[model samples]
Each structure stands twice: as structure tokens, then as C-alpha cells.
Target: MAEPKNEEFLDDIEDAEAQAYAEEMEEIDDEALELDQLRAERDQLRDRFMRALADAENARKRSDRDRREAENYGGSKLSRDMLPVYDNMKRAIETITDEQKEANSALIEGIELTMRELLSVFKKHGIEIIAPEVGDRFDPQHHQAMFEAPVPGTKAGDIIQVAAEGFMLHDRLLRPAQVGVSSTPAS
Candidate 1:
């Protein structure tokens, strides 16, 4: 009878200990789950922060590029407006009669001086002229051919005459050179 009582007490103690251990394991598992949730939230927040930072950087770069372009092309309209005056000055110098030039050296000199001053003004404002002389090869990038003339002593596709001079403002083409090209003579 005494041995039976001792066995029952031992069985009860073992059951109580097993229950306590199971409760402790459950608490530990709950803590681990909480920790995992916190880590996942932290990772998501970090990714969002990185994306926002990248967007800000991209916007800053875009703004800087826009500012630079504005600075580069600020005077485009003014330069374009002044092109006709320059062209007229160039025409005046080119169309003078040789006899008039000889008879009135002072008038010719004054015209030449005015043309030079106009060219200087163009250089100051970032406007440049494109005029290819005769015998120069015709380039489609800067020259537009009005017609092809059959001539001798010149290669085909060579520039024979410049009908209208071209102009540019800060590496941008304002006008295309109207030119006459040469073709092979008829055999």
C-alpha cells in the first residue's frame, strides 16, 4: 500500500512538470513570432525609404539638366531675329559694282567696315554663318541643293554656287544653305 501511494505521487509530479514545460515552450514560440513580425516590418520600411531617396535623386538630376539647357539656349530667339540684318550687310558687300568701288573708295571702305562690325556682333551673340565656296563637296547636313548644273572641270556633287548662306546659333542650325551642285557633263 505504501509503494502504491509513492508511485501515484511521482506520476502526478511528472504530469505537472510536463505541463509547465509545455507552457514555457508556448511562451517562447510567441516571442519568436513577434520578433519575426518586427523584422519583416523593418525590412519593408527600409525598402520604402530607399525608393523615396532614389526618386528624390532622380528629380534633382532632372532639374539640373533642365537648368543647363535653359542656360545654353537662352538667347536663341534674339539671335534668330538678328539674322536678316547680318544677311543684308553681307549682300551689300557682295553686290557692290567694281566701278563704283574704284570711284568711291571711302564708300566701299565704309561698307566693309559696317559688314565687319556686324560679323563681330554675330560672334558676340553666338551666331555663325555657313558658306561653303565653290569646288567644296556638297554636304546634306548643312547645305540644301536647289539644282544640279552640268559643268566641266569639277567633280559631280561638288558645290558650284551658294544661293543663300546658312546661319547657326549655339550649335543649332537656324537656316540651311541653299546651294547649287554640279553634275557630270553630257558625253
Candidate 2:
């Protein structure tokens, strides 16, 4: 009877140990699940932070582009309004005769000086003159055809004459050069 009772006592001890091991394994499994959840949350937060940072950088770039464009093209309207004054001054200087210059030398000198000053201001402000001469290849991008005429010794699309000079403000064309295009057939 003593031997049988000792065996039963050993069996109880084994059951208790097995139960303890199973509980410990369950606890480890729960901890591992919680760790996986934490890692997933951290990854999500990192992704969101990276996206917000990219959006901020894009907004900054757009603002810089807007500022640059405003600085370059803000005064375009005023610059265009002043073009006629330059044109008139240029025409007056070109049409002046030698006799007129001799009779009014001081006045002519003043006019010439004023025209030069205007041209200097235009140059300083990124305004450029587009003067197209005759017999050059006609480019529609820079020249506006005022009239088309066929003339001897000229190919089709050849420039027959220049009616008026053009102006450019920076990379933009303020006015196209008025020109006459030849309608002669390409031979």
C-alpha cells in the first residue's frame, strides 16, 4: 500500500509540471502576438510621417516656382504699354534729315540722347528689340505676316519686307515683327 501511494503521488507531480509548462507557453504566445501588433503600428506611423514630409516638400517647391514667376513677369503689362514710346522715338530718330539736324543741332542732340536713354532702360529691364531684315528666312514664331506677295527671285515663305519691328520681354514675345512673306513656289 505504501508503494502504491508513492506512485500516485509521483503521477500528481508530473501532471502539475505539465500544466505549468502549458501555461508558460500560452503566456509566451500572447507576448509574441502583442509584439507583432506593436511593430505593425510603428510601420504605419512611419509611412504616414514619410507621406506628410513629401507633401510639405512639394508645397515648398510650388511656392518657390510661383515667387520666381511673379518676379520675372510681374511688370509685363507696364513694359508692354511703354513699347509705343520706344517705337515713336526710334522712328523720329531715323526720319531726321541732315538739314534738319544742322538747323536744330541742340534739339536733335537732345532727342538722340533721350532715345539712347530709353534704349538703355529697355536693355536694363530685359526688353529686347526684334528687327527682321529683308531676304531672311521667315519664321512665324518671331514674325507676323502682314501681307503675302510673290516677287521675282524669292522662294515661297521668303521675307519680302519688314513692316514694323517687334519687341521681346525676356523669353516672351511682346510683339511679333510685322513682315511681308513671298508667295513664290518652291523651285
The best candidate by lDDT is 2
Q: Which digits, one per residue and each the tens of the lDDT, describe model 1 over residues 7-91? A: 9999989999999999999999999999999999999999999999999999999999899767766777877787788778778
For model 2, the superposed segments whose C-alpha errors exceed 4 Å read 1-23, 185-187
TM-scores of the models, in the given order? 0.73, 0.80
What tens-digit string does per-residue lDDT give for candidate 2 at 43-104? 99999999999999999999999998787777889888988898888889999999999999
Lowest summed lDDT window (length 10), candidate 2: 67-76
Best by TM-score: 2
Off by over 4 Å in 1: 1-20, 96-118
The CA lDDT of each predicted structure is 0.87, 0.90
* TM-score, cand. 1: 0.73
